[model samples]
Every structure is written in structure tokens, then in C-alpha cells.
Target: MTAPVTASRGRVPASATAGRGPLGGASLPTWLAAAAAGMCAAAGWLRVLPGTRMALLLALAATAPLLLAAASRLLRRTASTRDTRPDGGPRPPTAPPPAPAPVSRSVPASTPVLMPVPLTLGLSLAVAAPVAAAGFWGSPARFAQAAAAAVDGWAHLLATTVPAGPAPLLATGPFLLVWVAAAITGELLARTTRAAWAVVTPAAVVFAASCALAGGTAYAVTAAAAFTLGGVLLLRARARDLRGPVPVATRPARVARVARAGAAAVAALAVAAVVVPHLPARPRVDPRDHVTVPDTPLTGVNPLDRVSPWLSTPDTELFRVTGDGPLPQRLALVALDAYDGRTWTSTARYRPAGSGVPHAPSGGRRLTVEVTVAGLGGVALPAVERPVRLDGPATLAVDPDTGLLLDTGGLAPGLRYTMTSLLPAPPQPADVDAAPRDPAPATALPPGVPAEIDALARTAIGGETRPGAQARLLAAHLWARVRNDPGSAPGHGYGRLAAVAATGVGGAEQIAALYAVAARGLGLPVRLIVGFTVPEGANGLVRSGDVAVWPQVRLGGLGWVSFGPTAQAAPGWQAAPAPTAAPLPSTPPRVVPGAGVPTPGDRLASDGPLPVRRPDWPLIALIAAAVLATAWLSPRVGRAVRRRRRRSRPVPADRIAAAFQEVVDTAARAGSPVAASATVRQALDRVDTAIDRRRPPDNDFAPRQADLHVLRELTERAVYGARPLTTAEADDAWARADRLRRRLRRPAPLRRRRP
Candidate 1:
């Protein structure tokens, strides 16, 4: 027969007769469930996806009722056992309770089977549909591309199977598989073992998904959803078991315990997912254009000579010059009198008839040239008729025969050379009357010369009296009228000089060649000066090797006079009288320099290489201080996190019972009837059951049997049992107890039915 229980002053008193059992010391699962739910909510606030949020909520909701029930049952069982004691003092230790009988098919059931299936399917569809739509409709190609790119990116991260398409799918597919598998596995484990598989299953799924989705889209959300769903199902199953035979009476306390554990697990997994994959050591980038410039000079290598059929046509720049002074008229380099299809050689070997010293005419002037030479292939420099001296560190030697500079080392930047050129007075008509006779080699023509040359020449010079006058008149007329269009057809090559003379229009090289041929035909000496022309403001003049082609006509007494028919030289020349004061001793042949020159210590005073400036120490100190401050704060944040986690841990079932008893004691002290020996779970369940029955369970003896059942199971499993309760089971028990407690505490008409 059951022993009779008593109450005192409308309050239930703590029992002293209860023996120590596993259930007596167990923590409630409710606190853990609540904690997990709270963590999920926080993750949602931090921008975790909706699917994840729903999954977590479902898990919490599904297991909450069960957890609360277990907590309530545990409290009741504890109180009843205590009340059976003979005295109020601590009871002697008793033998451990007998092992529960194996669950049989005959046992009555209260909950429905297969509750999670519908929910799981609905959630899966909801998550997948939108993703599918995005991939198929919004932009299939872009989706594919993004996926492919993401996969390729991750290929650098993980040793994964190569997918045919985008990379996101690789991670996404694996994530889905792992998540589903984990969920099923967790549910089965919970059903078979009554162990909380919620935390482990979800955590494992999340970890695997995170690894796959390190750089993938929606990874965090997917991982969270998978974990939450699996955990919730497992917890729900555990909660059901807790509510079955053994019941806890401390509903309120157990609820709190389950809530804390759930919250901690959720928070930890979320943080782990976010933090782990972001560690460095990412893939190396390979850019398309990554050619390294060669350090050695490129001489004798004509970049334009080998025209590869496989390569695109080359781009040729019509000379560019930069300098400080007004743009120049015409800057000549070398003269070419002979040409094959590929080469242009000078008429004959150069032979200097005079001393090596250049002789500028009486009206000569000094012009400083800072030439930056580039792209000259076997070509020679064509300076003014006479260049007195060159001043630059460049190792360019003068070819005495051709009066040109030769440097096999090839042209480079920052070349500075000073030249004193003879500024000859403009020629008068009488000067043209005495044209010079053709020189030996100048009169000889290349074999390919076109037949139309003689006729075209005769027609061009017919009106002029003298050969010199004729050549000048023709040159002047051609320059004014001929349009310089380099894009035109080759027009009979250099051999068709006569055809060019007739047309009176051609490219720069063509016109220059024609002039040479015409002048030669007229029995006058002329040379085809194939050299680059420089405009004023041209800087960095090194050796004369930089010039392109032009034409030069020999005057009877005066040497060759440079004339550019394609691009006329700058005008306005006033011949200066010979200097009376013996020209300032040639500037003592100073060691003028070009690029790559190392200035001596004394020369550092002049404009030398710029120095690398160092930053002020004060600024550096401030930056250092800021870094230190940040470092100092980081550990504080870490400590705060640890404290929060500790607080979030599942509350012990006894503590929950104590809290419930305290509430009851306070109420009892206020003149309400109370039982003489009662557990927290029993009081809470009695109160809820009494309300449900629409009748108070004798004031202090309020029935909370349902709640006690939940609490007792959670307490026994968590405290005395070796296996820890799962997040799902703890959550369910907590939720049920909370609802029952709230109802029991209600003022009036809304009381619930008692068991």
C-alpha cells in the first residue's frame, strides 16, 4: 500500500527519506534545450540563413515538451521517495535501484511515431526549390560558371573529385549528402540508444559541410540547418523516453538545465563553421600577361626581320620624341644609297678625306642633343654635315668614313650627346646653277630600278634651267603637294623610283628614294639618307643611330646639304658669323654621361639619383601603439566568450528542483496550503495536472506528474548515468516543464488539466 503524505501550512516540505539514486543527482535536459534554441536564435540574428533558423527552431520545439515532462517527473519521484522516510533528517544510503525492465510492445504510448518525416521533407523541399530555380532560371550559364569557378578555386583547397561544371555544386552536393545521412543516423541512434545524438550528429555534419563549402555559397546556412534538424529529432526521441516510466517532479529547474546545453552546442558549431575555413594558405594566382623583361641588351637582333605567319601583324610607331626645347625641324641619322628586298647598305665604304676633327662651317652654331636611341637595326647615324664633338658617357665610336656613330651594344635610354652643327645660309637661285657632278658610287643604280624612271625624271625637270635648280624646284613642289600616307601600297618598291617621281606622291621612304633617283638621272650628286627624323623637343640624344631616312644633295663647294622632302626641316635660320674669340677651348672634353653612369662623391651635389626617404619615428610609434591596443583587447573578448559558454552549460536537475521548491515555499509562507513532503517535479506536475482537471490538487498538493516524469528522466540520465543526454531530449523535457509551470502559475480560468 502507498504511504499517506501530509502537508503543513498549505506547503509541501522537502523529504528526508529519499535514498541516493542516479536520478537523484541528474541534471535536467530542459536547460540544455533552451540554450540550444537561444544559440540558434542568435545565429539567425547574425545573418545565418532562414532554413537553418527553422531547422534549429523545429529541433528545439520538437524536443522541448518531452524535456519539460522528464524534469517534472524527476522532481516528483525525488519528493515521493523523500516523503517515505521516517524522519526529516538525511536518510541512510540505500542499495541502487533495480534496472528498469526492458521496454515491451505491451507498454502504452502517448506520442505519435514518424513525427519528423513530414517536417524533414517539407524543409528539404523548401531549401532545394529556391536553389534549383536560381541555378536553372535566373542565369544558368552564370550559375554554371560561378559553380565551375568556385570548384576550381576549392580544388586548390581540398583533394576533391573534379566536377564537370561549376565548383559550388561539388560542395553543395556533398554537403546535402552528409547532412541527410547525419540526420538519419542521429535519429536512429536516439531511437535505439535513448542517447542524445543531437550535438554529435549535427556537429559532424556541419564540420564536413564546412570543409566542402569553405569558399562556397550559403555554406553556413546549409550546415546549420542540417545540424539543427538532426539534433532536434534525436532530442525529441530522448524526451519521449524520459517521459516514459521514470518521472521528475522539478519541472522549472529541469527546463532551465536543458535550455543551457542546447544553446551552447548551437553556438559552438556556428562559430566553428565560420572560423575554421578562413585560415590562410589559399591558392596561387596565375595571371595571363606575365612576361619578364630581359636584362641583357638586344643588338644585331632585328625584332621586325622575322615576320612569323602565325603571329598577328606588327605595329610600327611613326617615331616619337620628347624634350624641353621647341620641337626640331628635321633630325637625320644615316644615309642609305643601295637596297635589296631586306637590306639597305651604304653606297661605298666610308673614307674620311679630312682630319678626324669635324669642321663646322663659318656660320655654325652649337646645339645640344639628348638622344634616347632605340630600334635601330644595322643603321648608321645621320648628323648635321659636320659635328665637331660628341659629349656623353655612351660608348659610341665615330665611323670616320661615314661620319656615323657605331655602338654594337645597342641603343638605350638617357643618352646625352652635344653636337655643334653648321647652320648654313639658305641657298639662292645662283647656288642652284652650280650643282655638283655625280660622285662615282652615287651615279650607280641598283639592278631593280624601274624602266619608267627616265621619262618621269625628264618631265619633272623640263621647266627648270639648271640641274640644281631643277632638283630643288621638284623637291619643293613635291613636299607641298604630296600627301604622306604610309598605309598606301608599296607602289613598285624602291626600284620604281621613276614611277614615284611621276606620281609625285608617296610614303616618306618612297619620296626620299625618288628624289635620289631623279637627282642622279640629272647628272647631279645625291644620296638617299635612310635615317629617322627627330622633331624639336626631342630629348636624350645619345648616338645618331636613332634617325630614320631622308635625302641629301651635294652642293659644288659645300658638302652634302640635308633636305627632307617627306617632312620639311624647321625654318628660320640666321647664319652666325665666325666667332672672333677662339671658341671656348672645346669645354675641356668633360666626361659627359648617359644612363647607368655612377656619379662620384663630389658629383652627388648635382642632380643625382633620388634618395629613399625614411618615415618619422613618431608616426611609427603611434601605429605600433594602435596594434598593441588591438592585441590586448583580443584576449578579453576570448575570455568573455568562454564565460558565456560556461554559463550556457546544462543546469543540474537538482538546482531546478531547488528553484521550484523555493517558489513553492515562498507561496506556502504566504498562507497557501502546502504538502509536508514534496519534490519540485511533483509540486509542479501536481499544479499543472490540477489545473488541467479544472480543480486545484488540494492547494499545496498541485499535480505536476507529467512535468515530473520529464525532469526525473533528464536528471537521472545527466547526473547518475554514464551516457550524457542529447540536446534534443534535454530541449523537449525543458519545454514541457516550462509550459506546465507557466500554466500552474497562471491566476485563474486558463488552468490546464492534471494527470
Candidate 2:
């Protein structure tokens, strides 16, 4: 009773008769999948973007895919409409047949129209740019910088710790990541039937990346739910689109769809309940932790150098502290952990910090102190031994292991910040075995340390097997042996420390540095802490006179415990009185030869003075300069070598391409950078644009434009042409490229200036 249906190729077919659903328009589930990808990333970025901002951004991100999909659909329809002819061009019309012989005819499937890549990407940029500007820059003036950040902010984020604040620079990374994921996923789903295999798969990879970059907050349950819904919805939508519209679907097809949906729901429930929770058993290693911040010139003016100046300018107010809950008697600026026998420096790994610091292993009494800088300047923000939280306007960076805070925006006068820190308990006799030995700069013995210094350190510890007792005995020994001369010459080099150990006469600067070196020699982890001491009977005004350089030993369960070398100051030098309101329990001013603390009875022998070896000044200076020069030129040298190899490549075609790359690289170094992925012709065009922007009209300085044209043609031929290149042709290409490079390297003729 049914007429036979046949498929053929001729007249334009209707939507119901064509297989255009899957390859043409995006179904509802595809849209959901694209949207869910963005939400997954956004959910992870909750800490970076607050409630209202995050909601607004999410709305924009979700809407962008829809807008993009609509544009794509419209573009495809417009393109299809423009093609008026059939596959064989315009054909003559034929008369219809009788109704009794009613036959259904199907046309051969036509290739689905696709939105041009340029248009699709252009639309995506148009949609994402405004959101990036509004969300990250928030100001027209900063839009350009924000754009640059969008390109590379993710890299910067990798170097910073978690919750690295809501700064525009860091937030741009997450914003761009989510936006790009949505755009790509939307485009794929809209154009292809690979919903589960292709579209959702890419989104899942990006989701993993989002989770990695996101701060340490648990959103697994919510993200899992979104993934479940999105995956199921996307798959079902793709299946329906492949089968065409639901209302027209056959009874069997409808049953299949319902059955598939039910199965997917059940699977999702099972996985969500049983699988997601147990994934990734091992602790996740943060990518940010692997990133190291390069050393800057800040090391030159570190707090160690300020010791002498602060001591000399005794009465100058450094900062004033006002707080409750037993404020620390001492405040440290930085922990000096790296010693190179010449001088001690902190291997300060500064990264953008948030309000809360990750907790340290040891526990202590928590106290909150607020500080107002009077004359204290530079990057150091003095805080308690182990700061747990920082609340202030100043941008901060912290060393999580040491709990040392650094002010990225240099500390200036009147800068105020509140730091809540845990005051480590005073050194106890049982600490010898409790403290874990650090396997790094903390207890590392730097190269070139004089042998006598280690022997001297061993002498100070004196067969005390227990590390805590040994540390106490050593500190007490240093106090008894060394006289705290405030006017003593300042330096913590091996020579200075060795002399201090031998002569038994040193000020706080030498003693603290010497103690650190000695402890490292004894294999005990330590830090040379530089800060001001708060003395009793004095108000909160901490002066430069209170500058104390002391050593802190890491005990087993107690964090860094301050082991001061008790007072042995000269008669004339006395510590200023501090407020007795909230005395720091048990600990006292002992490192600076402060006049309050009692000296220990332990004293080590200094029977024979160790000879001080003067470092070779000129030789050392030359070596340092050479090392610096080498560091600067290494990259350039490596580039030259690479270019040489490229020019000498075995294949002539490769040589031609390499020649072009060398020129691009040189141009980029000169600040006119072209992307590595750009085609040769495109790169050359951009280079031309850069020159045109800068070149003056009627300027007599002529450039070889003809050479550039020939180079571009040769490069395009080498990369895309069918013909293989000859060695002679490759040589000639390199010759022209070298000329262009030299021309670029030469400073352009100075534009004649009129007085």
C-alpha cells in the first residue's frame, strides 16, 4: 500500500528530505554543551571574580555562543541562497507524472554550507573583546594593556600563587580562557555532528586546564553536575539533529530517543555518584609551583645591606606598631636563606599573594598587628615570624614555605597594613629531633665557605647531639665570646664572619650572619632575620636604634624559633624603652646587644685566631662582569647559531624557508614582531606595514623594496609551490635575506633635526 521512495540528484531538496541537520544548524544540546564548557571554567574562577561580576561575565559568555551560532546559520543560508543553479547548472523544466504512480524521490546529499573562518573568528573577537575590556580593564585608557594581557595573561598566572587577587592582569587569563573555549566549542558543534566525540571532548580538556589554574576551592560536585547535563543534552541533541526534527520522527525513532535519554540519565547518575569522587587519587601538583620568578635587581638593596645604615641612624623612627593580643617583641623584614660565602641573600621567590596565606606545617599562637610606616622604605614589609594573613592595599607576594611577605608595590611612608601571624613558641630543649632537616638553601652550605668557619661552628656546638640543645649552646657560646660593638664594621661575607668567629668581637650584623653560616656548617637549618626589636617601657615607636639582626632555627614541630645571642652590647649602646602594654611572652630583645635580656653562661674557646683571607677584588670584579656579559650574550649567540644552521639546512627548500624565518626573527628583535605561525606572504605584508607606518615621506633613505618582493615570492614558492628548489636558488635567497637583515640592523639615517 506504500509508494517506493527513491533518492536522486536534481532539484533543490526541502529540509525534511535533505541530510542538512547535523552539518548545518546547531541543535539545542550542542548549544548547551558549548555553554556548559564556559560555566565549568567560570565555576573554577569564583575566587578571582566575585558574585556580581562573575554572574555578568557568565551571562556574556553564554550569550556569545548563541550569537556566534546565529551568525553562522545566517551566513550559511545567505551563501546557499546566492548559488541559484543546480549541480549541472540551470536545467530545462519537465512535466509532472500521474498520481497513481506516486513515487518519492530523494536527491543526493549536497555538501553543507559552512561559515567562512574569517567571518566566524571576526564575530567571536567582536563579541569577546568588549567583555574583556569591561571585565578586566574596566577603563578605556587601559584597554590596550588589557588586550595584551588577554593574549598572555595565562602565562603570568602560572607564576603566581592561588587566589592571586582580582587584579586585571591575572583575571584576564581566566576571562580569555573561558571565552576562547566557548567560541571554539560553539563553532565545532554548530558545524559538525561530532558532538560527544569532538565538541564535548575539547571542552573537557579545557575544563581540566581551568581547574588547574583556578585557586584551591572545591567545585567538583557542581562541575560534575554541569558536565553530566551538558554531555547528555549535547549527545541527545546531536542524535536528534542527525535524525532530523522530532515531530516528524517515526514511532520507532521516538522510542529510541526516549530510551537513549533514559539510559544517559542513568549513566550520568551512576558516574556522578560513584566515579567522580574517586578520581585523581594522587595530590595535584600545582603548575604554578613549578614556575620560578627570575631574580631581579631587588637583591642588591635587600634588608641585609640596610643593617649598617639603620644602626648608624639609631634614633630615626622606622615604623610604629599598634595592636592587641600580645604583639611580637620583634618584627622581621625578610629571611636571609642563601649564603655564597661572600654575602647572604634571600632567594626570594615572590609571587602575587592574596589576603590569606597557605598554612605552614607548624602551629603557634595567632596575633594580629597593624603597622604604619614612618621612615621604613623599600620592598620589605616587616611582619611576625610566620604571617598567616595580610590585609592591606599594598600588593603583596609571599614565600609560602617561609611565610615572608614582600610588597610588590614598593613600601613607602604612611603605607599601612595589618598582618595576622602565628608567634612561634620559644626554643625548647626537646626541639633537637623534632625539626625536619631542609634539603635546600635553608641548610645548604654554599661553595667557597672557608674551612675554618665549619670547624669553628662545630666547636660552638661542642658534641651536643640534640639539635635544639646544640643550637642553644651555640647561640649562648656566640653571645659569651662575641662582644656586641654597635660601631663594628658591617659585612656578612666569609671574611667578616670568620674574623668575628676568630676575634670574638662583632656587632649584631656580623654575629647574626656568622651564626647562620655556623649553623649551616653544623647541618642545622636556619635563617638570618633582620628587623626591629620592641623593648619594654617604650611606646610603639620602633626606631632604627632597635634594628636587630638575629638567627632563627627551624625546630621539628615549632616553626622558625628565634634564638637570640643574648645581650653583650658596649656600655654606651642601650636599647630604647618600649611600651609595656602587651609584652611578647618569653622572648626578649637579645640579638642587638639590647640592654634588657640576661647573657648566657656558655662560652666557647677562641684560643687561636683564624687568619682572614682578603678576596681578590680586581679578579673577582672581572669574573663577575664576564659572567654577566655571557648571560646577556648567550641568547644572541644561540640565535646566530640557529640562523647559521637554518641557512645551511640540507634541503634547499628548507633553507629558503629558514632564510625567511631569520629575517622575521631579526625584525621581531627590532620590535616589529610577526607571529611564527603567519604565512610567509602574510608575514612580509605585516613587515611592509610596520615600515610604512614609520617611514617618512620624501625621506632620501631608500630601502630595497624589490628585494623584499623577491624574498616573499621565493619563500611562498618554497613553502607552498609544487617545484622543488635548487641549492643555487637557496644560496641566492640567503644572500638577499642577509642583506635585508643587515639593512634592518643598521640604524636608519637620522631624520634631520632643525634647531
Candidate 3:
């Protein structure tokens, strides 16, 4: 009571389906299986995709199969309704058959015509849970944001930091194409083929690529294999339901086909396992390295070099800090002493400084500052004046002279560090004169110093002999003229001369650099300090706007003392008394020397020794050959082991079935007439006929043919005889079958055997 069979056709006709409802509608399980396959494939991509945008990827992947299924159903319905009569008129309709009488017994209520919404939602949630968990584990906040913008965040949230390469589209293009094809192809193939293996092909390919690209981790490979097995099981079950039952005569052939399919699948996985590990790992570039330069002149630590678009966003919290008492007005990032005419950077060597905390100055107090960084992104760790001790997960390196923190890594979000520093005392005239002798390197000027800069310095100092007096005069002069406006700042090409020519109209960076350069031009030691200024408010919310810069001049005994030269100079610096003549320089001031070389112990430590590598071609070849050989032979070995296991089973009929299957598979592989649709009797006859048809048959072929015929009879008896098959008889049949198989595989005689 089934639709007409098409010989050797693997699948049941659509009209003879078992699980379909009375109206021939698609079954719910079929739909769910397809959706699950798509969902698992999407989940597999989580291990390879770069960002916390799993919600969007999963939503797209899960819905694709459903959409394809709906489209397929619509196309089938349209095809069924179409009239195919050659004439321009519709064919005449036949009389309808009589309706069957209804039974009195109760039946289950019919499902609605529409797809089940709750079931679909439940399946989607099930698929989305693992992806969500993974995203949360990696980055909770970013994942939440991506989920919130699932409908429209693809462009902004789903991206890697790597730049577009030669084939930019290949990265995402192949993944999407494979996803859509898998959904549509799997749905169509499910109906045309008995097994759903074809439906999962695209998904398998994608999963393999993902594993290879993700460095072939054990977890990734295992997950992909498990999902593939699940898809195979689901497909096989649906195919079985559609096909109904297998006849006893054909069971042996079916088992052989299943074995072949399994071997093929195992071979594919073995090959992937052997090859994927040797593939190169993916490379990614950090987006933070490509900072743009500002259009206007810069001063403090070359502030324009660190300018970022994110910092310009209003109301964004940058960082937060807490200290024991009042915080210093400024927190230095680094001190720049080497000016390259165009920019200022640290070029001095650094030595290891101990972590032990240092005592505060005579009148200053010791306090600890805890900093919690937010949106800022840089390698520098900002701390109060003269950090003595740092405590954090990251290793800390400091410049002994400037006390600037060395670059460790990017300042990631949510980073917290504690710094213990000494509060620096306000600069005083007596303190400046009491400082030790200043180093000549601090006053060295770059080559080709413009006459305009020299004239401006000479005019600002006006014959002042004291170091502190000259510094104050130049600072006040620059502060009076600079407006801190971009339009009024000097343009590029002339260095500090341009700023002096423009009447010092620039921002903190330009003015600070102007003061440092002018002080150095007058044979005074000075350096630039770039840092953040603490506002009067105690909220402790530091925004990008709070960034500032100033100059620190070297004194006789007090060391380097800070002085603000911008229009926004702190009140303390402006109120400091002018330098006195008491502790004058050991010798009179000299003319500015050419830029001096940076001595050792000025910056961060040097890199360690690199490791050596030598490639061994012979060893590499041997390893590759071993992997390839194992992958190639694994399936055959597995098939042999399975056959041996079946032979040892207690059931006699199972042994007969396994032995007979081996004969049919071997004959088919040898290109003999052992058709899959043939019965056991027909297959035996075909084997005999094939032996006779061979030109000059082997001398032992006649005896092998007789043995094969006897074994076939035993197999038929075991399958259909009234009496049960005995263990002794099954063993005898197995022995004869193995002998005949070996003879059939033997080489034919070349001559008439010495006739």
C-alpha cells in the first residue's frame, strides 16, 4: 500500500510520505531538524568570528533555513496547481471518489495550518543560549550592547581590527554564501534523497573552514564533529520514516551501503584532522597604532600625535582617581627632552628602579592614588607627581629622572592601578637657587636654530642672569600673548620660530613647547611635561578636555621645577617669588650647544635576545607522510574491525548477514554485476554469470563459483527457513564464503597452465 517504486531510487515518493499530515503538509520534525542544523552551524562560527556580535550572526543563521523551507513549500504548491494540457484549455476533471465514513473513536486535535510560533521561539532560544554564554564570558558589556542592537548593529559591532587586505570581501562573503546555500540545498535534498547527508554538506564545509582558521583547537573540532553527527542522525531518522521498512532479502545490501557511507564520512574527518593542524594561524592588526596628526602646531609631548576622535566625544568619562588628600593639579604622562624639530619623544635609556616607596620632600606629604581607567586607550599609565611605588597586575617600568611610566601595553577598559607618590612642594626662588648643577644636555638645541627664536628669547630675558628670573620672564611673556585658539596658532615648517612670530597664540602644547624651546635657546635647561589638570570640582571625572601641558626648568639644588607658560597657568606657579642671586651657577651661562646625545639610563629597558630557528626538511616530510598515510588507510582498517566484531556476535543470522555483505561489496568494488536492488538469489546468479563471461577464466574459478552458490543457499536458508539458523551451520557457511572470496580475488593464469 505504497506509491509505485522507481528501481534503485533511494528516496520514497513525496506522495507516499508517512509523517506528513492528512493534507500532505510538511511534518513538524522535519522543519525542526532543518532549523537545528542551521542553528548549530551558526553556533560553530562563534569559535571563529572575531567580535561579541554572536546575537546578530545567530539570528541570521537560524532564520535562513526557515525562510528557505517556506519558499520551497510555496514553489511546490505552485507547481502542483499548474495545468499542463497541450491545448490552451484545462483538462477535463474526473468524478471524485466516495468519502470514507468517520469513526466514532476519539482522535487527537488537528494542528493549526500555521507553523507553531511557540515551538519555533523555543528552538531559537535553545540555539541562542550557548552563543550568548560564550559572548558573555569573553566580554559581557560589549555582548549586551550587540544584543540590544541586533536589528541594526551589524556595521558597527561586527568587525575585526585588521585592515582590509587584497580580497577584503572573502572574509565575510564566503561564510554568508555558505550559510544560505546550506539552508536551501539541505531542504531540497532532504526530499530528493533518503539520507539527509547532502543537506549538511555545506555546513560541514563551513565548519571545517572555521576549525582550520581558528587554529584547529580540540574543542572546536569536537564540537563540529558532534553537530555533524547529530545532523546525520536526524536526516537518517526522517529518511527511515519515509521509506517505511527494509525487507529481509535486502537488509544485507542496505547494511553494506551504510558501511560504505560511514567509511566515507570517517575518511573525510581523518583528512581534515591531518591537514587542519598544519595550516597557518590567522593574523590581526591593532587599530590603535594609526593615529592622525593635528593640523595645528603642538607642544606638550607632541599632544597632536595622540589626538583621537573618541576623545573629542562630549560627556564621555575618561578615568577616575582617588587620593588620600587633595590631588595635584597635574598628572604627568611623560617628559620630552629630545626635540627632533618636528616632534618631541623620549630617546634616553632606562634602568631598573626598585619598587620600594620613597620619602616625601621636607614639606610635602606621602599619599596613595587609586586610578580606575575608563575609555582612554594608550600604553602610558598616568600617575601623580613622582610616583614612588606602583601596584597592579601589569608590570610597571619608570624613568628615573622624569619619573614617567614606561609603555607596557594598551590602557584597556576597567583597568585599575594604585600609585604611591610624594606631593611636590611649590617652586620657590631659594629652592631653585639651592638645586645642584644642571646637566648641559637639557639646554642643548637642535641644529639650524632660527634667528627669530634666538631674538625672541633674548628680548624676553632682557639681560636677566638668574635662571629662575629668566624662566619667569619668558613664561609671563608667552602667557600674555597666547590666546589658546587654533586659528591664531603658528603653522608648520619653522618649529618654535613660527610660534614666536605668531605672538605665541596657541594651545597649551604649543605654548609649553614655546617656553621650553625659548628657555633652552637662552642657555637654560628645560623640558616639556604633558599630563592632565585636575579641575576645582571634586567629582574626579576626568574628560579629554582636562588634558594640559607645562615646562619644567632645571634648578641648582631643587632639581627640575614645573612652570606653566600657557594663558591657563595654575595660580601657584604664577605666585612663586622670582629667582634670587644666592647659590648662583658655578660658572657663567654659556651659548646653547648643538643637540647632545642621550646618555644611558634615560628610558625603558632594551629587548632581550631572540630565539634561533632552523627548519628540518627531512623531519617535516616524514611527519607529513605519516599523517597522510594514516588518514588514507584509517577508513579501511575501521571497516575491517567492524566486520570482525560482527562475526563474533552470538547471533548466527548476524554472522551470515555480515559475511554475505562483504561478498556483495567486494564484487561491486571489482566492477561485477552485484546491483544494490538485486535479491540474494539474483545476486548469486549474477556472480556466476560474471565468472562465465570473463575471457579465459581462472583454473580454480569453477570450484569458487560452486562454493559461492552453496554459500548463497545457506544465507537464504538463514533469512527465510522455518527452522532457526544454527551456530555450527553459520560458521561452516562463513568459512566457505571466505575461501570463495579469496579465490575470486586471485590473479588469473597468464598461459594454459603449462599445457
> Clash totals for all models, in order?
139, 12, 12
Q: Which ten residues in a row have the lowest lDDT in candidate 2?
A: 601-610
Q: List, residue by residue over 1-755, the lDDT tens digit for candidate 3.
A: 11111111243322233323422233456556656665666556555444345436554655654665555455555555566666758878968733211111222133123334355434443434333434433443333433443333222212221111111121233334334544554344333333456656656666665444333246566777777775776586556545444544445646875887787788667766656655543322222223321111112234434532222443457788877776554566666777767766665333222242222122244667888888756656576766656666423444444555543545778888777776543444455434444664778777777776777778877877777677766765655555554233342234544655456455456666777777888778877766665555745667775565667776554556666455332212222222321221211121112311111001111011111244455655766786678767765775576667657756786577666766665555445734333456656666555444444346766777677777777776655555678898778777876775664454434542111
CA lDDT, every model vs. true structure: 0.40, 0.62, 0.52
Q: Is candidate 1 or candidate 2 better by lDDT?
A: 2
lDDT of 2: 0.62
Q: Output the TM-score of candidate 3.
A: 0.41
* Cα TM-score of candidate 1: 0.30
- Tell me each candidate's RMSD, in Å, in order: 29.1, 22.3, 17.7
lDDT of 1 by residue, 471-563 (tens): 655555455545544443453355445546656555556666666775666666666654443422334232232223455655554345444
Q: Write the per-residue lDDT of candidate 2 for residues 1-755, one digit (tens) a residue.
A: 11111101121212333224433445665566557655655565664444566557755765576567756665665665454466857655657733222111222234345658668766776667766777767764556776788767776666555555666776775666666667777777666553456766655765677566553424555665676566656666665554333322123434654775476556546544543343333334566667765423234387888877777777788888888765567777877877777777887666666665653323456788899988888887787766666777736677766667767778789988887775544433443334454344478776777766777777877777766666766776776667777788888888888888888777777887888888877878777777777755556788877777777766553445566564524345563322111112335533444444443211110111112345556655655575567556655765665676677777887777777767776777666775422445556666565445444354423545776777877776765567888999899889888877775565544561110
Candidate 3 deviant stretches above 4 angstroms: 1-35, 44-186, 194-197, 202-540, 543-654, 667-676, 682-697, 723-732, 743-755
Per-model TM against the reference:
0.30, 0.58, 0.41
The true-versus-predicted C-alpha distance at residue 520 of model 1, in Å, is: 1.3
* C-alpha positional error of residue 333 in candidate 2 after TM-score superposition, expressed in Å: 0.8
User: Best-fitting candidate, measured by TM-score?
Assistant: 2
